[model samples]
Structure formats: C-alpha cells, structure tokens
Target: MDESAIRTQLNDAGYALVQVEPRLQGLGSTIRPDVLAWAADNDGVLVPWAVVEVKHRQVAGHSAALRQLATIRDQLGTVDHYVVIDGEWFRADRGLRTATPISGPVSPANGADGVLQDVSLATSLIQERLWNAANRRRHDGQRLDSLELFADLLPGSLSGELVARSGHTVRADRDVLWRAGRRALTAFTSQDKNTDLFVSHPAIARAVAELAGDAISGTVLDPFCGTGEFLWAAADRAVAASRSVELVGVDFSSQMIEIASSLASAAPVPARAIQGNAYSELPTDVDLVLSSPPLGLRLPTQHELLNGTSTKDGDLASIDVAIRSLRSGGRAVLQISPGVTFRANGEAYRQFLAENVRVAALIGCPRGTVPGTGTGSVLLVIDKLPPTKTFVSQLGEDWEDQLSSGGAAITAAVAHLDDKTAKAT
Candidate 1:
C-alpha cells in the first residue's frame, strides 16, 4: 500500500502518531514495515502501541508478506499487529503462537501526513544504509582502507557509492547525519554491531554537558571522545550559555577522530578532535572536562596526575588526567565504575581523595546507562580547586526522565556547585 493508504488504515484503527520507513530490526536484510504507530489521543509520551505492514492492492508474494508481519510481531513483542493487503486487515499476533492465518478488521481513522521526525530513528536509518552499502561493497571484494566508507558518506564527501543503498545515489541529509552521529563509526564498520560500551545514551551526554557547562566555561575537553557526543552536547549547550567555547576531543581510534572532526566542524564553537593517546593529550589550561572514558582498563605504569595521586587503574588514571588537565578552579564531569567509588581496598585512595581531590557531586546512574553493557556506572562531578562538599543522589529506573528534567539531581548538583563557586569567588 502507499503511504497515504497506510496512514488512513492506521487512523481508522485509531493510531495517531506514526513513523514511516523505519529500519525495523531483527531481520535478515532491511525491512521497511511501512508505518509504526502509537494510539490515538495517546501519543502517550511516545509509547508505541502497534506495528503495521502495508501492502499494495496488487502486491505479489502473499505468503512472504504474512511471514514478514509475523516476524515483526514476534520481534517487537507487540499484542496488536496487522498485515494489510489490498485494503484488508489481517492480525498477525496468532501466528506467533500457532499456525493461525493473519487476522484483523477492515477499517480506516484520522492519521497525520508524512514521516515522524525522530533524531534517534533517523540516525539509525542512516546507519543501516551506510552499513548495507559498505557490506555490499565489501562482499563484492572492495577492500576498504581505514574510514573509506565513512569519509565518503560524510557531507560534501559523499562519493555517491556510500550513499547509494539500492539503485541510484540520492541526496543525503546532512542534518540527519549530524543529529544521529551519537554512535561511533565502529558500529557500522565492525564485523558485528558495536558493543554497548561504545554506544552511550544521548540523554547522558546532554546531562554531563549541562553539568560541565553550568559549572565552568573556558574550554571543554573529552579525552576519550567517541564520535564527540559529549563535545557535541557541550558545544550545543554553549549557544544558550552565550559563551564562545572551545571544544577538544581526543581518541585513539582514527575513525572516531575523523567522524568527530566532521561533526565538530559544523558546531557554532571552535571545536575539533585530536587523534592520539588521550592520557598524553590532556592540556593544563582547559577550564572544564567531561567524558565517559573506556571502562575496566589497566595501564602498564602507574599514573600520578590528580594532585600526585598514583594508581595503575585505567579509569582511575583517566579520571586523574581529567583532573590534572583542568585549571586551578576548573571542573570535570566523568563516568566511573561504581566499585571504584566504595571499596575496602580503596581506603588509601579515599584518604588521597579526601586530602587532594575536591569532589562536587556523585549522581548514580541506573543500569544500562553505559549502553550495550550490564556494567554499573555513575557520574562523578568534581572541581580541581579545593576540598568541597559533594551533593549526592541516586536515580531510579526512570534515569532518563530524572536526567532531562529541570528539577532533577543533575540540576541540583549544578546548583550546589554554582553556590560553592560563588562563595569561593
């Protein structure tokens, strides 16, 4: 079925919000399920209510279409699913349980026009296209060099090959790429999907950026900046703070640096990414630092950057680097493992922290905050100035809501830090 017919049937069946041409997952190849929907009078804060697959009246392969709908129904774990063929509605839910034929109502409601604009989904669609094109080329024996596919698909760098999904190379949307660039290029370049650790939630990036920007201003650096999400958030936050900020992102991955550089170049601030060992790239003049560096890493040599504190722990070393990189009164917002925060063996480090480190706040994040992983994590907001009181709050399962809301723990922590800064000044 056409886009309008699909929308009409969904509206007839009571779906108000719809997303078209979504790269519905858990399938062999890309499957365009036509429209995904939420109930009428209930965009309901964007909770999806049903999945629909629309077929044109004269569409062929009736058996394959039903299989597709059944797979999507099972994949999404949805109770309501439909295979609308030739204007007839067939429910695919029973197929998941038994050999039941597709069943449902033949009806039509009020629906909106065009596709729903979602940053996350739009970026995923781009990601799928880039991956499919690259995979096709790779399968065709095209040995890519470094970030060949990424370099080409980027704005102004589109060689047409990477942008061509099926037939001809079409116009690529630079805006969608910019918004969807939260994930590393490795997510598409890798032999498999990126590990959860590489893909962090954009909400966390925004929260950390706000925390850092609200506290300090001169220059913001993310040492392990993958795809520059933290820096992107920081630079975007700079617009409202009315500050002409400088952003610097460093990473060992060349692909990450290339993509980060491309994304940062379009920012309203002076932003860029440096490719090198992040530990060696920390500058002393930076005013603020924020990042979710790699977890569970170990260094061959001990690090002593955070006011002469020495330790071989990888993340600890990263934290120390962020601390030392700050100016005297500069601050940093970082994500560190929960175990490092409280350990019987860490009493010596605790003493060191009490004497040397000036922690400002500790906002514990809910599980899955690290993305694609089960590892527990928390945000550590600190100042390099002097010993100070630290605000503390633990987020429940509704971490995203708490992080985004104005009255949340992150906002309160910023207030505490601001108050502390005022008193010292």
Candidate 2:
C-alpha cells in the first residue's frame, strides 16, 4: 500500500506521522525508516510512539524487512514498538514479541513533521545510554565487559583483547572504549552539577594531533587526558604515517580514567590509561605530550606541583608536568587557557619556558570552539631545547572552519617551525 494510506491509518489510530530519513549521528548509522508515529499529549508534546515500515507488496524476503525495522529501532533507540505494512495488511511488533495484526484503516495526523521529533528521540536515546553507563561501577577492578560489547557496535576502528598487566589480565581496548564512555560520564556529570566539564571538542582534539606532527614516533602522552580524545587522534595519525607508537593517557577522574583505559586498549599501537593526578609523578622520557588541561585553577610552585604535592594552579601545573615528562628533544602540543600568557604566575612560567624549552608556536582558538566554554584558548607547542623564533597567529572565530579543512593554520605554522629548526640546526 502507499505511504499516505499507512499515514491515514496511523492518524486514525491517534499518532502524528512523519517520514524518517537515514542520517548518521553519534553511534547510529544512516537508517531510513518508512515513517515515525508519535503520541502527542494535549499540549502537543511529542512522546515516542512507534516506527512504521511500508512495503509495496508481499515478497518472499518479507522477513528481511522486519529485521531491518529491528535494526532501526536498536539504532534509534527509545521507541520499542514497530509496525510493518504490506499492501492492505499490517503487522505490529512490540519489542521482542511476535508481530500481530492491527484491525483498522491506518491514518496519521495532518501536517505532522517528524524531523524535530526524530532529533529529540536521538538525543534522549544517547543521554539514556550515557546515564546508565556512568552509574555502573565495578569494585573488583575487573575490565568493563559491557564496553567491549559496545565497541563492536560503534563505527571506525575499534577492537578489544584481554592482556596481562600488573600481575593480572585486563582488556586491551579500554582506552578505545573510553572514547564513548567518557562522553557519557561528561554528560552525566555536567547535568548533575549544572556545569561544563572541560571536555575537548573532537575537532580541537584532531587539530592538536595534527600540530604534534605526523612524524611523531615513540611514546606519546596526554597527562590531563579527559576522555582520551588526543590519544585517539595521535593513534590515528601514527597509523596514517605507518609508524608504531605507544599511547599513554592519564586523568584524575576514575570514571574518565576507566573509559580512557578501555579506549586505549583498542588503539592501533600499544596504549594504556592511568588514573592519577597530573601533578603526580608520571612516566618520564616520553617523546611527545599533547593535552588540554582543565583551566581556571591556581597553584603555588612548579616544584610542589610536579611532586603531586600541590594543587595551586592546575592549569599551569599540567603544562609543567608535560614539559618535565618529555625526553631531551621531545615536543609538547598543549591546549592552554589564553590567560596563561599574562597571569602573574604565568609570567614565571613564561620565564621558565624562555630559559629552557624552545617555544615553537602559539595558535589562538576562537571562543565557543569548546562548546560550553565561552573562553578562548591557545595551542602552545614547545620543545625541550634552547629557545627558537616563536610563530604566533590568531585562528579567528572561524577556527572550526580551519579545523575542518585539515587545520591549515596549524599545519602552516608547524611547517614554518620545521624550517626554523632546520636553519638553526
């Protein structure tokens, strides 16, 4: 039967109907369901009702259509009821139950638009999954087996393996799992506290990785790795370069750390996530460090901070930790608060940088690039050697546009820095 006829039946059955187009969002792939029906309250608030699939006529492969409907429900989530229409006959499947016939002429409410409602459904479904995952806790330190299952459902490169570590076997893909798990934690925590958790945007994360240079090899670390985005980006770059590197991520949030560990387990290279203070003793002699540490915090002294003994200015301290963690000629690409270049304590830090590290580049990021963070940020690249000509540039408000085009600004600056290094050498 035609879709209009199906819509009429649903409308008569008290549902607002709209056609759903296949579009990729978050973990869901492109899916085009014939129609979506919602039960609207008296105030016209749309509550998810059911998904409908319309087939022209009865075919021998009818079972495949039903399976496709089930996949849509699983990907879209929220709604559990689905209906399949073939010619004049209709079958409704509620959750895992068998499909049953509904006796009526299908009709849908006039002028019902499903686009806005579908967006709402997608957001609600993602939030629900994140909430459930955030609340689940394991006391025995066993690997998060559920995350391994989730990895299989997600797109891109991800897999898991149980490996021996610290006298026990653990899931190797914990850090890869963290890519999604940490987002859930961030969402849940943000809602609970009504505050923005300094989660880096994926674009910003990719830009930072690009700034680190694709030639990067050996060990890489993100001391204040919130959700392991930088580590993931670095891993992807290393894979593109056909180079093998070890990935290490550290974050104080146990939840964040757990997710990061799970995610790193699935990286193309050897990777591990640690739950510890960035101010504490970290792995030394690392080749590169890329991180966006939390801002608006103060610290007393760099010495006290590095020993994991001070929490005066965590923003500055994280940079100090990154600098100290690097090998003699290693590089660090850090996302720092804009104010770090002028604050009183920042002066001392700058003086330290001038005396020790080679300041490579400072790329300013536009405001709102970090979503909840209205404050602007800067990407600071430094090498553990004598000073060099510093290349500084503003990324403007369209920094995201630059990022989308392969972070041209950052790439050019890195190229200039490479030339400067070559001349100096």
Candidate 3:
C-alpha cells in the first residue's frame, strides 16, 4: 500500500504526525505495526493528543489479532486509536481488534479501494462522533439525519434507490447513499450487481463513456447488451442533452432481452433492447458502440468461446465485426480483459486498430472494478478521431490512495494532444 499518499491526504486535512511505529520500536515482534501516525495541536500551553497504530495486511481472520492489539493497547499507556487496513478481499474483523469496529463502512459498492476510502471516511466519522458526543447529553430529541445534513451532496434522485440494490435493509442517509452510489458506478463488480434488478452503477459507465466522447448525435450500439446497461447509460447522457439517443442493444440471451426491456421501460430514458447473436448479428453503420462483453468464463464452456467453434464462433469475433462495421469515422469503446493490452495474440488487433482507426486511448480500471473477474480487464476507449490528444493525468501524488475521481487522466491525455497539435502548427 502507498503510505505516502495516505500521509499526504491526512496532512492536508489538518493532521500532523506525532510518532510512527518504527520510531516507537518493534519489528518482527508478534505485532508488526506497518503504520504509526498521529495528529495534535497545542495552544500557548501544551495539549495532549492521541496515538494511532496502523496495521496493513491482506486476507482475513483477525479475531485473534484484535485480541493481540487489545493487549498491546494495555501495555502502552496512552494510545488514542489503533487501526488496521486490510485488502477488500479479506473478511471483516480479520485485521484490527474486534473491539473498535471500523466505524465508517465504505462498501465495494463505493470502490474496491474501500479499505483506503474507509480510512478517509473513518477520520471524518471520528470527528463527527466526538462533536456529536460533546452535545449528546445536552441535546433533546431526533437530531438531523446524515442524509438531511448533506442533502446537497446527494446525486441524481434518491427516492427510488435502496441502500443495497440487492434488497438488503441497510439504510443510510440520502447523502451517504448518493456517495455510495457514485462509488458503485466505478467500484461495483458483476457479482456485487448480480442481485440488482433495476438499479446498478449506471452513472460510472455513462460518465466514463461520455468522458471518452460518446453522444446521441451518433448511432450508439451496445454489442453485449446484458440487460441494456451501456445503452441505458448512453440514453441518460442523451436525455440530459434534451435529446433522445438513437440507441440499439444486442444480446445473445433472449432472457436478458426480456429483463432488459422491462428495466428500460422504467428507465429515465427510452431504449430499444433486442435479442440477437451479439457476435454475429450486430447492426452496422453505428457511429459509437460501447459494450462490457461477457468474458465467457461462466458460459456453457469457456474453451468454446476462447477457441471459437464453427457454430458459436464467439463474441470476440462479433466485437471485431462491430468495429469493422463502424462508419468510416466512427469509434467504439469496448471493455476487455487487461490481458488484451499485453497479450501477444492481440498484437495483430492492436496494430489493426492503430493503423486503421486512431487507437485513441487505453483506460485501466481499478482492480476488482468488475468483481468475480480475474486480474486483467479494462475499458478500451478506441476512437476514429485520429491519435490526437492522449490524456493521462496522475490521480494524485498519493500513489497508495484509491482513486477518488477519474477524468483527470482523460484531461491530461487531451492536454498532451493539444500540446502536440500546437507544436506542429
């Protein structure tokens, strides 16, 4: 984990380090404290502050560990808070002492960087708790709910949304829910959305596509239109522009079409969802095409799709056909396995895209962005706009911090192009 980034965010937020673990001494000892940072302020007189020890690890099962932390706290007289940061893959309570339950829970719905996001959220929550606690005895009844406090932060409409789209009763303030939703757009995995019937992280998909220049003026087609997610995202962008999208969705499963059509009817904008052979029956003359094609892992036979049989032929071919069918100047943004970026077999396709179309940009999504999937998958933003500007902005100096925002890279890429164009002129 990038500790420097975490320190940067904390320092900027008015936190100062009082001491770190290595300074306190203890390595290879049963308790390995990877992080030790603290904040304190003293007026003309000296004031006391708290000490925090951070333990970072991957995997799960931390009950015994927390018990160990409790023992350490007892040995060390004055300690404020002890925290444990674990990877998202780990089960709860596997790192920190079970005593201080990580108060602010930032689910994967927010981002796989939940562990890091949890840290930021934890800081704010600690302050809020202290502030509320000071007033708790004096206050009367029914304080402002979190949603009501930060109503402005709420994104889109919040009425139809549930805390967990899977029908879990975990309720949250509307503001928290909104932030959670935005995270969902970027962080949700296919598994996380498996139970979602209508609402999924549609905004992230739409935002990424729009940032890559998807629009309604062009014919936007979705190749692997699983329940018409990308099509609906495109439609939302179009509707926001006071126009309707000329959208078409193709799915290999009739069952998916049925569910997608029903979902679209309730969408903010109308879309056409159809059942067809995604790889074989894609419509031509599309101006902009976007898809999160099935990786074919859970399909009847993974080998069938990868090897490409005469009957099934495979969706990859369908995607290729979609690209070929694009109008001379059109572009397609396809989500593919990260292996596509470096795989030797894809060198031909890469060359084809670079020579024929402008290989506009390659965007890498965070790990676990599409859960239940393996390590290498990304959203490939290919355009016919020529190799103009390739924006690749650093998310932040905090290399360890989970990405809070995107478009920074896109902006950088665009700026890079502009510089080149200016130089040429």
Q: lDDT tens string, model 1, 293-352?
A: 877777788776445556777777777788778887788899877766885645666666
Per-model CA lDDT versus the true structure: 0.65, 0.63, 0.45
Which candidate number would show the highest lDDT if scored against the true structure? 1
RMSD for each model, in Å, please? 10.3, 13.0, 17.3
Greater lDDT among 1 and 2 belongs to: 1
Q: What is the lDDT of residue 179 in candidate 3?
A: 34
Prediction 3 global C-alpha lDDT: 0.45
Q: Candidate 2, residues 59-93: lDDT per residue as tens digits? A: 53346657766776676553534455555454545
Q: Quick one: ranking by lDDT, best first?
A: 1, 2, 3
Q: How many backbone clashes does candidate 3 have?
A: 14
Give the lowest summed-lDDT range of ten residues in model 1: 158-167
Model 2 residue 347 lDDT? 71
For model 1, name the residue pairs that clash: 1-55, 1-56, 11-109, 12-108, 12-109, 90-103, 91-103, 91-104, 196-372
How does each model score on TM-score? 0.65, 0.61, 0.46
On the 0 to 100 scale, the lDDT of residue 305 in model 2 is 39
